[model samples]
Target: MSGCYIHIPFCAQKCSYCDFHFSTNHSYQNEMVEALCTELKIRSESWKDEEFQTIYFGGGTPSVLTSGQLQKLIGQVKSGYRVSNQVEITLECNPDDCSTENLTTWKKLGVNRLSIGIQSFNDEQLKWMNRSHSAADGLNAVRNAKQTGFDELSLDLMYGLPNMTAEEWKSQLLQVIALNPEHISAYCLTVEQRTALSKWVKEGKLTVSSNEQQSEQFELLVSTLKEAGYEQYEISNFARNEHYSKHNTAYWQGVKYLGIGPSAHGYNGKERYWNQANNKAYMTALKQGNLPETIEILSSFDRFNETLMIGLRTKWGVSKLQLFEDISPDKEWFKIVKDYEDQQLLIETPESIVLTEAGRLLADGIAAELFIIN
Candidate 1:
């Protein structure tokens, strides 16, 4: 089944660590909405008639949109695409943007899933992160969503802060467990270039977490969540039973999807395309009847490398035998896999090469080590 992702490039305010395409200017709200709808129409006509199983609204903050604006966008999607009756419609929201009224309206507009960005329950952490919501706002938002009958709730949390203690991390996890969300996406705070967080670190205004601290927090997360009966479906995601995010899992499995809006990426079985990240440029090009995107045709090696990278991040490991089936297995790939296996970092079954729990802690490094150099 195909999936669709729509990026809403507006936020209440820019987060310190966020590098996503977004503006805090409210003046462009109406124009942005119009451009998004136009993009949907433009992309939909070119798309083959595939029934969509998932429709995800992600962004700088999708919750910034009003209920009326949301209804209009969903209506456009319904008119343009063949969405299945069982579509998993998700809306990414921030606590400050959610209220009882808005939650009811969101539910009415076919939003079956709510992904709330509740990074931390601690007010200090929230302030440090420059989030648009308070700790109380976050707690209220979850209750409002549940009251509105959204059982498919996923909360985003972050660990590995510069001054956070292990006790604080454990406390946050316990609090989340108390809320009883269906899924939890816990991420380590990474300082990307050009973000405020990086600048603060450089200027000595803020301290970044050391590798050891990050590793410790990750271990705490896995052990704590597992004890609470959550499965580590992905390296960074935990879910209860069959409630894993179908939309995200489809992407990890290399399924075809259409992405609309500025700074969005789409992948078919063969090629990948990314829309222009600049909102003004995207709207201007689309208004001039252009798609405003760049495409890359994947080679055999490229596809193989991608499959290897994505497969390792997932619980469903990649088959070593299947690697040779897709491309000529070279000594370089074999050496990397064998090195990891010998270290007990990877468990090599006859059919699959799976990451051990320790290996998952260093997944990016392991995946990078296996990249097919051109």
Candidate 2:
């Protein structure tokens, strides 16, 4: 029921659309890797009694780690925590790093899943996004992973770019389907502040897609993936039945997990904590044997809002009984639920409150509107 996440904050180059925590500077790469191992040891002491069902290597790019580095990290996990035989170990990789040699080494090291970031299948799009790999690199990466006997492969696809025709979007989806990955996660491109994409837009060097185009592309993704026999497990994730990602699913299920390394967040049932985002600060804190994370004690209202927000994003939906009990059966909640139901945004059954497909597109707004003030 619990999981572990290790953040690897290194990338060959920063993507124009990325605002994630990472650096292309190799000056501290060796130090960072050592510090990460030290952080893992410090984080795992409390979890020695519990077993993890999933261990995710997420980040700027986990594939950047060498075989030895990867092995040593997994070794620490095995020695420090009670790991289950059925644990899903997923490594998030960039297409340029998914070589045959690396895939084979990862397989030997017990990595059960590979989530490759393919973004898009058009070279122009890749260049526009400042991605390091070409479309051919993505195709080859998938082939290499499969050739190395990896059955649990997931591909990340991006859509809703400026000047990207609907036909181009369809072609991208079709190309991914032809690759026969067990799972596909389609994400809509957004221009986040502080990113090169945002700067370019401000400077009139880049244009963002219209909201209508984004919505249309999202609809296209759902329909195309459904027709291709992939279940829309989440709003953005599609998978062949039983191939859903366990690591991410645990988050939606509100399972407790421990996160190690800089910029990582951890949740243990009632409380949540997040580590320092700066690498130098994180290393200094860990060197002093301190767990460098900000802690938050969840109030009842906080818990209710979170459950309502995250639970509604999944296919399992939020249980009506649980919701009623989690939050008081107050006039505010009752009014919110009734209003949403009247709008046909939610289906209220005896057991749960589920969002219809139409409601899902506007999920964040709906969840925000329903949030209760303490």
Candidate 1 per-residue lDDT over residues 1-374, each given as its tens digit: 79999999999998999998898987888888888899888888767577789999999899989888889889988899899999999999999888888888899899999999999999988997899899999999999888889989999999988798899999999999999999999999999999989999999998988889888999999999999999998899999986999899988877889998999999887899999999999999988888889999988788888887888888887756645556776787788789999998988788877898889988889988887767
* Residue 278 CA displacement from its true place in model 1, Å: 1.2
Q: CA lDDT of each candidate? A: 0.89, 0.89
Best by TM-score: 2
Clash count in backbone of candidate 1: 0
lDDT of 2: 0.89
TM-score of each: 0.96, 0.97
Report how far residue 59 has shifted in candidate 1, in Å: 0.7
Error of 1 at 326 (Å): 3.6
| CA RMSD of each candidate after superposition | 1.6, 1.3
Alpha-carbon runs more than 4 Å astray in model 1: 319-325
